[model samples]
Target: MVGLHLDDIDQRILAELSVDARLSLVTLANRVHLSRNAVKQRMERMERDGVIEGYTLRRGSGPSRRVTAIMLVYRADRMRGAGVVAELARIPEVVRCDILSGEFDLLVTVVAESMDRVGEIWEHVSALPDVENTVTSVSLSRPIDRP
Candidate 1:
């Protein structure tokens, strides 16, 4: 199934899984209006087709538990090269990075164990060859975090 296509049920399954990967087969089937066996078969097919990769646990963030920060990065080469992004990918604390259309070239979200770790990540990112400048802001309170 090199050119495998996903239908509505398949899309729904993926959507539900994205929200909660630990959902039981029966629960997933109920949400998608399918039998448990059918849901299992579809999920298995999706895994074989490379549509469904391995699941990961998303840790929770609370006071004195985790530190989250957003770094706005400006690269010397702008968006011409992927070297900076490749380097950022190696840092496990860097959770999300998005290319923007404003003054900042990339918006990086880092969730580290402590403020000192965030500082270390900031310094590492600042010292990168292609990085021109970076502005970082630590999250005070996550009032509305969807993910």
Candidate 2:
């Protein structure tokens, strides 16, 4: 907590919310020794101050029916701007994308309902204007996963 602006109560609020952002105001208030309205005001203030960015669902920990694949993309233009990123964001199956510094320009994680859908996504990505080549690896099993 050194060099940080958060007080003890604010830190506790963030800590509790990190574990369960859906916690009701009453529960949070009881945990933090505050009224429901006080907790709500603190949360709202934190959100406004950018101390809390936004809540997100942590994936890959629960049971899923989807298949996941990693695609290594070689872009012809080498990510000239946000065009490729904007396009990637449009694809609902593209869970994550990273710019690389090796044989490929981008690494993308695709999750889909079936192998057929994964192939379709691959084709769609390859057809993008900036993409030159791609290599896809399907994840068969994950023995070690942090999330």
Q: For each candidate, what TM-score against the reference?
A: 0.59, 0.57
Task: State the lDDT of candidate 1 residue by residue for 1-147, as single tens digits.
Answer: 555666668766876775568999999999889999999999999888877778997666743467889999999998899889878755657767789998999999887878999999999999999999999999999889783
**lDDT, candidate 2, at 39:** 89
Regions of candidate 2 where Cα sits further than 4 Å from its true position: 1-63
The per-prediction CA RMSD against the true structure, in angstroms, equals: 7.6, 10.7
Candidate 1 local accuracy as lDDT?
Answer: 0.84
| Overall lDDT per candidate, in order of appearance | 0.84, 0.79
| Per-residue lDDT over 4-30 for candidate 2, one digit per residue giving the tens place of the 0 to 100 score | 355557766775675567899999899
Question: How does candidate 2 fare on TM-score?
Answer: 0.57
Flag clash pairs in model 1.
Answer: none
